[model samples]
Target: SSPLDPRYTFENFVEGASNRLALAAARQVADGSASGVKFNPLYIHSSVGQGKTHLLQALTHRLKAEHPEMRVLYLTAEHFMYRFVQSLQTQSALAFKEALRTIDLLVIDDMQFLHGKQIQQEFCHTVNTLIDGARQVIVAADRPPVELETMDERVRSRLSGGLLIEIGAPDAATRRSIIERRIALTAQHMPGFSVPDDVIDFIVRNVTTSGRDLEGAVTRLAGHNQLTGLTLSLTMAETTLKDLIRVTDTRRVKIEDIQRVVSKHYNVSKQDLLSSRRTRSIVWPRQIAMYLAKSLTLRSLPEIGRRFGGRDHTTVLHAVRKVEEMIGSDEALTQEIEVLKRMLEA
Candidate 1:
């Protein structure tokens, strides 16, 4: 009956540089003992399923783990509004407000859902009560304070007044790690289940958008295995995950998105990128685009070659190799590609 998932504890939360700041801030909020305003309202902002909810739940879990009797509450913004509305209609608003004030740590998720003047008013009042009482409050939203223009100014200010932590888009390495972690979690349920590293790398290279997508891939693979009782292999991964391959935002990553992002990053025109020009400028960007297509999609070398203005498989192979070599030694190029990959995935 708890709002927090029992499994979302600090031990399971995988951290990388992108999310390190947010994780540290959440831990601080959870450990601070002052009854007065110490990181009064910890604001966490991240795109969907980037571990903001996980971090919030982890904070709650740690608090309760450390202090069994501590008063705590965790609810989505929708649930908070629902309770507030129900209490008003039932003439028990006083009880609702009193109960909220008693919680030592109040965690709210999906704060972007808080809208409407009445709901905003109630949320603001509740936040004010918590902050004024020096009780810790945490909120998660898809956007930061300035972008959430619909929210009350006072509430927005209060949220921004304290610490603002952002759970950024996870990089390729981090995404791969997350996929491995999810696979390990799956193994806990199915004793002998296992997935190969290359298969996991395939999923990582393709499902670049969010942690949820990685989890979904793991779930699908597990479900398929459970039904057929077949061990997982690259061939199985290729066939079974045909739909999940190269998808971001619950849909397939179009060749156009990758081309557009790469072209923009390298300052080349899309037409020139796909054209026959072998200029050093056009060559490398074009190669990168091809490399991304190969790694992120199921497109065959010939298909990819055909897409790049009748270029041969040999040319595409050369480009892919050059980029891979550069990625291995060229730190600047690697960073550039990482940014582009993140954009395409986003």
Candidate 2:
């Protein structure tokens, strides 16, 4: 049987600007109409707990419902590795390969963990064969295909030649809806176990990490109420979730954190941001890091400058101003900065 989660269907998946494109793409793939080949190998990517797995499983569910006779397989990259090795040990490698090739729809999750040279080659072959035979394939990873640095180049290129959709972090409104949904679901099991508006706002404001964290907050609160018979209050939530809040609080964000996140997000290096290079790629990330340092941290201009390649305070000021000006005009830059901020805060 496939390892699909029954709770993660499209009906329950929350919709927002962050995940709309991913959801739409997933729906189109599930429909498997004339456009099936157009999105043959749909690649959905996002940071952990941003609903990447949920969307993949939702599509798997819909595909199974629409084509009951069709074969569907959902497994993680790690599990795939295990099964491949097991088949080899049991002298059933050919059977494993045959079973995999016959699947009508293949959904692979956590593909970033799909390591090992032989495993990736097999994966690439399976993907190419299935796609060539007009079967559906869907994969999800923490980052885009290009960022799967350890995977085979051929595999990356093959996945890249499909519909790539990124599910960004949920904004405030989306976060609010997620929290309320979690609370409502919890109340279904435990009568009158509700979070007050003020408490909900506090959780939404504090847990700026991911929907998974928001769900954890609600679960934690519900657990406390069930055991302690305590009424949910803002103060109680503050005290109970202080550990979660402390980690994601923006006030605690540091320059090094900004540098690391910016470097990874842009595929640049922390050293590159600190280097004297003047290339557009390097300069843009440096300016963004500097701007984030000024906004998120309390370091003085000179202090921040000292940390980032020991430049002058004036440079930091210029970067802050430059980013501020762009935020008003450059919509992409605005979103990029927002994503970085969420990463740092999380």
lDDT of 1 by residue, 1-346 (tens): 1367888888888888779988888877677653355576888887777888888899888887888788889889988988989899999999998998888788899998887788888788888988887788888998777656467888888788887888776788888788888889999999878887888888877776677777888999999899999888888888877776645552234567788888988899999998988799988889999998887655667767887887898888888898999999999999988887788766
lDDT of 2 by residue, 1-346 (tens): 3477899999888999999999888887777762658887889887778898898889889878878887989999989999999999999999999999999888899998899999999999999999999988889998788757578999999999998888877899999999988888999999998888999989888888788888889999999999999899998999999887765534347677889988998899999899989999999889989999998866678878888998899999999999999999999889888888877766
In model 1, where is the ten-residue run with the lowest total lDDT?
A: 245-254
The TM-score measured for candidate 1 stands at: 0.69
- Best candidate, lDDT-wise? 2
What TM-score would candidate 2 get against the native?
Answer: 0.74
> Please, what is the TM-score per model?
0.69, 0.74
What local distance difference test score does each model get?
Answer: 0.81, 0.87
**CA shift of 54, model 1, Å:** 1.4
